[model samples]
Target: MSQPQPDPEAPVLRAEGLYAAYDGTQVLCDVNLSVGVGAMLGIIGPNGSGKSTLLRCFAGTLKPTAGRVLLFDTDVATIPVRQRARLVAVVPQHTTTSFAFTVWDTVAMGRHAHLGLMQALTERDIRAVSSALEQTDCIHLADRLITELSGGELQRVIIARALAQEPQVLLLDEPTSHLDINHQLDIAALLGALNADRRLTVLWVTHDLNLASEFCERIVLLSNGHVAADGDPLEVITQRQLAAVYNTELTVMTNPLSGRPQVVITASKNEARR
Candidate 1:
């Protein structure tokens, strides 16, 4: 079966005039974001800045109080539940299983969208799961119970599940938030490789500005539910932008190897003022 080839000029994912609220309080206000096919865009912001909220809207997991989310020319809200799953997959900040399930069985769940009720895993499903395990380097943990895995291990398993969906777009929320340095780099390299190899459109939400700057092709900085800046990392991750949004003394420097900007929180201005 041939998949729909995304238009080069058009964005694979788009958020137009998005406004979301929780308990009568707005979380995302008039947010607009667009990402082309094979592009990796990072959404960065401080806590309560609505980065995750925006991602949830794009994933169709949360309905915006107002405005529409469009995924490849089709309104996400209009797509049926199962069909939508095949088009986009989301890896949330935290995923847990109440009961222990084998890694292989968990990854196989991603194929549910393509299967009928109670249908057995098809040959195609096996191939997809195997490929996902290899890409995530979790093939060794196939028989391990999810309850026995560490945070980093679980994160990779979750991503593998998302990859098994064969989605055109991947939505990630703070994927590296709880990971150690090595695991963080591992996930970043994996995402970069997949994006380059399969032309996967990715929108990732992150609090780590330096990591986002290094991997993301475009960065959208949000402040208090509004888009503060949108451009390349060099344009958005500046000292002035970080200070103003985070209320901290920040130092922005160039990475000699990649020539990308890196942000550093240099001082505790809040403590100094207090």
Candidate 2:
């Protein structure tokens, strides 16, 4: 049977009254959100605020106990795993492999979704992998072992693997969490470019408020398993909202270069006197 054609007019992804629990402990409650086609949305919140959990639900790796996730107006749970992999790709916070796999081989794994059982990589699959590597600037490292790459290089390789899937939507959980400032900026810029050039629907969970503010077209702030704020960076990433959710003393200021909100941590009076 032919797969259901996506409704172009519908939101690319939507969660309705989502509820999830892990080990019988509720993590998400009544979460509702919609991601439009080609949108770049960032999910931000304090640790344990269900940011990753929500992302897992959307990725179909974790089934919600209640409610549903819709991809192009069709239920995500009903889609076959391979079909879903073709439409959405996920980049987790960390990737590990004990065996020595070349960067090219690791990236080529993404083509499994498109291949039949025991099938070899076709010309199209090879092209996709090569394109992904090139797009992520990882082509130079194709012959290197994934275990030998730096954190930044490894992260880019992981993203390249995802891009090899040719997914319409990308779901990432803290893609830059382990990188240094420079690498973080590099990854962010790469994602921004992909979003603009390919119109890829990007939804990522991040703790870096400033990164989210600077890069995301929209931000959703989760607090206590609920959406505390959802809007453009300026509107959702305010000092008031962050202070309340983060329970910390911080200031939100406009970046001189980007005009986006930049979060600044403020020292307490006791610390200031030291």
Candidate 3:
């Protein structure tokens, strides 16, 4: 079966008047955003700012209380689950499995959406899985158990699974969180290459201001369930904007190499107590 092509004229992903809640408490409100093809967008905010909530709505894992999410100009909620998986892939912050699955088996599960009932992996499927592993630099670990891999290696394998799905829009919720500096850079570089080379529409929720500023083409800052700011990194990640939202003293400096904003936390008056 052939995959559905996205409408060229419409934004790859869009949220209009999106509102979501957990139980009775609202998390996101009146959120409106549009992501064009191949754009790398970072969703940044303090804890409980609805960044993950919004991403969940876009990924169609959560439905909004009001308004809607659109993928390829079609309402995301209306898309079939299997079809949706083919278009939008999400890499979550954490993944755990009690069963021991090989890296290859885990990644190949991404092809489940494309395969017919009881259908075996065809040559095309094998190629896609191999390509995903190679792209994520985890082909050598294909035979290894997922539980045996390190944090960085496992993160790469998870990404390889998403790539195997051949999604047009990739949504990551803090893909680099908890990773060391070197691994963080590796993930960032890999994401950059995928966005540039494959033109994948990438949107990720991250708390690392510097990482978002350095890598994302645009940043959307959310505060108290509302969009506080949205624009280029320099525009959204300003000292004033971040200080107000984060409720802290900080400085935003221009990185000499990337010409992007780098966040620096300054000592607060309370620091004297320490």
Candidate 4:
């Protein structure tokens, strides 16, 4: 694969004064953010904070009522859908397959943006698919039916599909929401390692503050469609911030291994009295 041509000085993706609404109900309000090349950024917020809307705008799948999204300085809306698909890939929250396609077959679908209609795939396409499978550690499941795979397996296959696109920027919406604890950690570790090796920019949307603290270098906390805090996890995931945004009680502590901030929900007994 050729080296990515990303501007180190400029953000790979930027949102300027983003605003969106449905039937006059505003969702995102004047949200402005930037994602640096080769950096992993996590977007965290309570429900209805417009996390998914922001991603959809970036993906060029949802047009905003206001604001503009730029990809490497060019407006996302100006780029053709097929061309944009090559530059960015989104791993949505929900994934389902009915045809029972083999893992390889499904992953190869990501290369459609690069091929002409009905055109035969070249050696390049096959190599890309193979590399993606190996990258996501799904090579063992290459020939397995997607329908028969477990949730964790299916998630990796979806990631492999995105990898096959060879995008410079990857946007994931709640990638770990449906997985068990072990799989969640596995996915987080995989993303960390992949980001280190490929230098692909990642924008991960998640509700788990601890996971974001462990994996992402920087995080943006959103509340009521605006940026509440944007900085290192230690700074953003504080007790005050969580209480304010989530409107709940919690405890924040330092992680011994990473030295980043970790959160714990305090438990109290109804019959116990201080």
Q: In angstroms, how far off is 237's CA in candidate 2? A: 1.0
Off by over 4 Å in 4: 1-8, 269-274
After TM-score superposition, the amount by which residue 238's alpha carbon in candidate 3 deviates from its true location, in angstroms, is 0.4
TM-score, candidate 3, is 0.95
Superposed Cα RMSD, model 3: 4.4
Candidate 4: tens digits of C-alpha lDDT, residues 1-274: 1234345478989999999888899989998988889878899999999899888988988888999999989999999989999999999999978898999899999999999999877899999999999988999999999999999999999999999998999999999998999999988887887788998888899988999998998899989999999887878999999889988778889998878899987556212334
lDDT of 1 by residue, 71-157 (tens): 988889998989999999999998977889999999999999989998999999999999999999999999999999999999999
Measured by lDDT, the strongest candidate is 3
User: Which residue segments of model 3 deviate by more than 4 Å?
Assistant: 1-9, 268-274
Show model 1 residue runs off by greater than 4 Å. Answer: 1-8, 268-274
Q: What lDDT would each prediction earn against the true structure?
A: 0.90, 0.91, 0.92, 0.89
lDDT of 3 by residue, 166-220 (tens): 9999999999998999999999989989998998999989989999988888899
Model 2 weakest lDDT span, ten residues long: 1-10
Model 3, residue 46: C-alpha shift (Å): 0.5
Model 2, position 154, has a per-residue lDDT of 94
Candidate 4 deviates by what RMSD?
3.8
Clashes of each: 0, 0, 0, 0
